[model samples]
Target: MQITTEVVSGLERRLNVTVPAQRVKSQYDARLKRVAKTAKINGFRPGKVPLSRIQAEYGQGIQQDVINDLVRDTVFEAIEQEKIQAVGMPNIESVDVNDAGLTYKALVEVYPVVTVNSFDGLTVERQISTVNDADVDTMVDNLRKQRQSFAVKDGASADGDQVTFDFEGSIDGELFDGGAAKDFKLVLGSNKMIPGFEAGIVGMKAGEEKVIDVTFPADYQAENLAGKLAQFKINVSQVETAQLPEVDAQFLQLFGIDLAPNEGGIEKLKADVRKNMEREVKSSLRNQLKQQAFDAVLAANEIEVPKAMIAEETTRQRKLMLQQFAQQFGGAQQFDESMLPDELFRDKAERSVKLGVLISKVIADANLQVDQDRVKAMIAETAESYEDPSEVIEYYTNDKQQRAQVEAVVLEDQVVDHILAGAKVTEVTVDYQELLKRNQQQQG
Candidate 1:
């Protein structure tokens, strides 16, 4: 076999391979002999069919198989001979199998050579957070709200009241599509509906009928409804008042705190909640620092990632989003791929690919390896929140795939730590609530 190579623009190369006609004939004849061993045809027994007869009957498919095998067999050797690191599978094209030779082209993306001077000059912020008593108090209030109950009340609905009503909305005196409902339940202050829609129901007594004007926000998701004036004709069927249980034995017990008549069970509950909050705060702090480290490294590096890697990453991200949607909405097969265009994930994918290349370089230069002790500790921390942590730990420990996933995360954390070690780090104290808010905004 003889090989020639061409650089087809950035990161892409084409390998032209040609096996001599004699070699092609040799492989073809060998395949024909193998086929004849299992050959079955009229007036011929197995292993007795003529090679020429088998070739005549199945030459087309056998030729394709031979070319495919040759392409697989020779392309890597050609790539090695060219001394280029290929990223993914080569796309074979311009295949020709005949008297002259078996010739083809394999187009592939070559991996770029990565270099980094130093992360020492990179600046990163170390988030310093302490989950205080006030945050714990806020969390306690939220927990109470979660366990809050509602009761049927014959009175005006106010903020926090659950209201069941029927309403038909109209624009310009004409009812619009999806502008009506019957016995739709809503919390007056939940903001589940458009601006003014929920507020309009506040203080509305059961059995009251009214029409209120509402203007959709200028940035509303529906173009037709955005900034448009609409009036809703509403009938309030029922209003239910929220009832939060007092901090008593039952409420305390609801949180696994066994209250004693003369003891400070509420304080005990707050302490327990505070411990959980502290755990969350610790995790949040680590995540914030890791993110900062990643941003520092990414900002400091300029790398050109292969489009093929970006494309693959984009596809993986799209499929992950679909999987999440399937878990949330229960219809994986019903989703249309076109709903999520590749453009939606392209930029993120490119950034991720670039950052991945940088992270890999850091790992290589630092000679980093996955720490099994940290892996065990991370797994233990994760399983701590479960009812039966031992079972969860056992499940993860015994499942190689799951354990490897955790190990990968551990190594990523180590990578972040190494980067931070080299970075000009400064501690920034952030309030717990402020940190949470910032995290939410960043995620969005």
Candidate 2:
């Protein structure tokens, strides 16, 4: 066998391989012999068919199979011999079977070499936040609101009030589907309806009747009603004001807290809430820092990402997106994979692949390995959210894939820490609310 490689372009290698005719002949003859042992024909018994007849019947088919197997086997052998780190599967450009030999050309994309000088000059801001008394008080108030009750008020509906009413809507004097409801409870300012529908319900008193004119937005999901003006005839039945529950034993019991010998009532609850909030704040801060570190490393490194890798990642991302759509909209079988265009994921996939390459290089250079203690800690932290933390931990510990996934995350964090160790870092203090708001905005 003889192999040769040519650099077709960036990260792409065109490999030409030639297998000896004798090798092909030997494998073909062996396969023919195996087939002939059990060969059955109209007039010949098993194991009695002539070689010429068998060749005449199955020669081309057997030859094609042999060539395909040889091509599949030899391409990898040639790649290994050339010391190429191929990304995705290779595309066979051409194949020839002649007197000279069995020759084939394979086009493949190889992984690029990544280099980083130093992370000492890179700068990133780390957000610092503390959950103060006011923040805890606000959280407690929000919790109270979660368990709030409402009582019917004999007055006009107002913002933050829940109104129960019956309404019939029509467009251009003709009623449409889903344009009417009875005894529907709507919160004023909730924006559950069209822009003006909720506002129109405000100021309405029980037993009062009115017609509200609302224009659907131009980009409404319902094409027939988009940009159309509709009139809703509504009859208000009730208005209710929110009533929050007092901080008492009942409220504490609601959160699974009991006034035992050592457990304090509201104070213990507040402390637990504060602890959870602190955990969450630390998690959010760590996520932000990791993202910043990754972005910094990505910006500092210049590497040519393999197109094949990007394409593969794009395909994976597209499938994942389609899966999410299926889960959100219906079952997996309900949607077609072709509905999502590949271009939708190209940019994200490219960036992800580029960063992955850079991170891998950093990990190799720094000799960063997945820390078992950190993996266990992460698993424990994750399990803290579950009712049975021990069960969750056991599940992860027993499942190899789950444990590996956690290890990968821990390894990535190690890389991030390595980057932060050398990178110039600046701490930026932010209020808890401001940090949360900024995080939400970035996510959005």
Candidate 3:
């Protein structure tokens, strides 16, 4: 066997492999002998079929099988000999497999050679948030309001009030689809309806009929309805005003808690609120730090990323997202491929692929290995949260791929931790109110 490789690009190569015809003939003959031994014909006794007949019957099938096997075997050998790390599966059709001194060529995309410059002294300010008594008090008040009651009213609908109404909407005097509802309950200040819809409903009194005109959002999901104007003939059914419950013993009891259960009910609530708030703050900090780390690595490394890796990642991301979207739309429904374009997530996919390559390089450079015990501990931790912990653990154990995914996550987390150790993360102290404002701004 003789192998030759030509670099197509930075990460792509064309491999031309030539196998001796004598080798192919020898294997073909050996396969025919094996088949003859197991062959059973009408006249020939079992395990005594003639070689000529066996060859004539199965020669093409045997040749194809042998070609496939040799291609796979030699492809790996070529990769190993050339010291190439492939991105995904090679383009098999690009390979030309034939007989007379068997000649085959395969087009393969290999992983890029990544070089990390530095992660040290990379200054990134992590906004620190605190949960104080005031924040906790606000949280408790909000919780109390969630347990509020509504009083029936004969007055007109107002902000913060609930309204029940029947509405028929039409586009240019012709009723458009999904624009009509019977006795639909809507909250005035919830912002659930299109921009002007809720505002128009706000001043409507019970039993009053009015026509409300509104335009659909320019980027509405339904292409046919985007930026279309519609008039709704609405009849208000009822109006109601909310009455928040007082944060006292009765309200506390509603929360499955008795004041005597803790030294101070308000203080206990404050502690719980603080713990939850701290978790959110930590999560935000982690996300910010990771993004900074990723940006730092990308900026530092000037290596040309493999296009094949990005394309593969893009394909995987699309498939995973489409599967999720299909499940959400309806079970067993065929996904509309036209909805998701390659341009939609091409940049993100490329960034993700590059980040993955950078991380893997760092891990290899540091000689980092996945800790088996840590993976098991993570599995246990995951199962501990479930009611049937043993069953969850057993399920994970049985699913090799799922278990490996979990292990990869654990390993990645370790890598992030290692990067954080070297990263210059500057702590920014912020009050609870200020942090809350910042968070709200970020979300906005």
* Winning candidate number (TM-score): 1
Model 2 Cα lDDT, one tens digit per residue, 129-232? 99998898889998998787889898888998889999999998999899999999987887778899998998999999999999999999799999999999
- Once fitted onto the true fold, the runs of candidate 3 whose alpha carbons sit more than 4 angstroms away are 40-43, 46-49, 93-100, 119-123, 254-256, 299-304, 311-345, 366-444
Q: TM-scores of all models?
A: 0.88, 0.86, 0.80
Find the 10 residues in a row with the least total lDDT in model 3: 92-101
Candidate 1 local lDDT, residue 230: 97
lDDT of 3 by residue, 283-323 (tens): 56666666766677777776767777778788888888888
* Candidate 1 segments whose C-alpha is farther than 4 A from its true place: 34-64, 97-100, 152-156, 217-219, 223-227, 261-264, 387-399, 442-444
lDDT of 3 at 383: 79
lDDT at 235, model 2: 97
lDDT of each: 0.88, 0.90, 0.79
Cα lDDT tens digits, model 1, 207-268, are 99999999989998789989999999999999999988788888888877777755569898
**Candidate 1 residue pairs that clash:** none
2 versus 3: better lDDT goes to: 2
Error of 2 at 349 (Å): 2.2
Q: Which ranking of candidates, highest lDDT first?
A: 2, 1, 3
Better of 1 and 2 by lDDT: 2
Which residue pairs of candidate 3 clash? none
Candidate 2, superposed: residue stretches over 4 Å from native: 165-184, 191-200, 207-236, 318-331, 372-402, 442-444
